[model samples]
Target: MAVHRTVEPSTSELGTFTRQNANTIHGHALACLVAADRYAHIEHEIKPSLHAGDTVICDRYLASTLVLQRLDGVPLEFLLDLNADILMPDLAVILTASPGLIAHRIAERGIRHRFHLDPTMPGREVDLYAETALTLTAKNVKVLVLDSSNATPSELAAEIADTLPDPR
Candidate 1:
């Protein structure tokens, strides 16, 4: 699993702002690390293991950046150009749910950041994810959109597994 941190500014630095604040520092810090780690892992473990027909499953990939970064106000084209040289995914699984469900769930678990507290977050995230899935699908990558607000991780894994052909 990999998630690139995009423009993570301290919430305190926002000068006690409201959820409407979309201002961010769009740094490549975490993105750079993920990109590096991805390259290293692919070069070291994944590529070597491929016998021309094997499939690799990643919990998060470039699509994550496009969706999340766009929410942070970074342009989709910019994100893609940032990762232009990186390889594309063969399949993408996008999980979505009602904002109300997500909001209630997060309330139960408490909040994480400005993102979690943002009233616009749930809807924006859902839209970005759908947009990302559509974009990837148009590029010929298979995409499975899962409504995961109800599934446990184990159940989700099982469902995803059914979508892929077993190399075995």
Candidate 2:
């Protein structure tokens, strides 16, 4: 089982996030998310909040930058350029399921973010994530793409843990 990190952003950090909040300009954040600088900032400012050697299962990360920036008309190369030097995850997992299945899941969960506001955004996100997986794999990054159509989170986590290299 993975120990997930929950980094509570300090008031300053939260202010930074809110001040540069991507929602200000985009049709909605999903369409106009500017996550280019967030990856670097997190490592610089929030890394201390996490355990020294824990696996950080980031919810939406650099790939989110790539997708959202592209959606917002930023060039892929430009967006990737901004985040090229940021530390990559050790075991990146891309969960996949049918758009229908994902739609149902989101419908039940009720999101607080812009990404889930539009029903069509989920479909776009899935396609973008698939492309992102291919991009990541090409860079020699190890990625596990799992279909979460029926698997529970525990089962999925176990599958992922089994695939990860031993910490020792």
Candidate 3:
């Protein structure tokens, strides 16, 4: 199995643009396009590994794009159209926690970037993720949502591992 992470590419360049133009419709759309291009590049690079039977586990993929873009006011239909051809994950694990808990964790670990710059972002993100999960499920994608409030990391990992399909 391969663990691939979808990090925000061209952050310095695109991030500067995003920071300056936060909440602008066109700006947000441009950022989404940049992210799509990055995902495409990563998919091309890992084609061989996938062909050789590795189960790629991407940390964040299309789901994130959906949620973030929606939060930026992009219509869900538009987001779905944008990602029509992107590969879908076999299992999408959405880790959720109460906004208070998430805020606490961020306070302890520190904010990574401007995405969490707003003190209320955790709550908004949590709500959007829940909606995203429902939408993805409606579209027939298998999803597993785990509440992170009470579970330890090890416990969550064990549950996810157990949920994987049995190897033949």
Model 2, 84-150: lDDT tens digits are 7766766678888888888888888877556667788768778888998888888778889899999
Q: Give the runs in model 2 whose Cα sits over 4 Å from its true position.
A: 1-20, 27-42, 45-51
10 residues in a row with least lDDT, candidate 1: 2-11
Between candidates 1 and 2, the one scoring higher on lDDT is 1
How many pairs of residues in model 3 come into backbone collision? 0
Clashes of each: 0, 0, 0
Per-candidate TM-score against the hidden true structure: 0.70, 0.73, 0.79
Ranking of candidates on TM-score, top first: 3, 2, 1
User: What would the per-residue lDDT of candidate 3 be over residues 19-90, giving only the tens digit for each residue?
Assistant: 455444453565466465545545663455467666556566667767777666678787787777766667
Q: After superposition, how far is residue 77 of candidate 1 from its true place, in Å?
A: 0.7
Order of models, best lDDT first: 3, 1, 2
Query: What's the lDDT for residue 71 in model 1?
Result: 65
lDDT per residue for candidate 1 within 19-127, as digits (tens), equals 1243343335444444455555555545555534456666567677777666656677767766767667656888889989988888999986557868889988888
For candidate 3, give the lDDT of residue 77: 85
Best by lDDT: 3
Better of 1 and 3 by TM-score: 3
For model 3, the superposed segments whose C-alpha errors exceed 4 Å read 1-27, 166-168
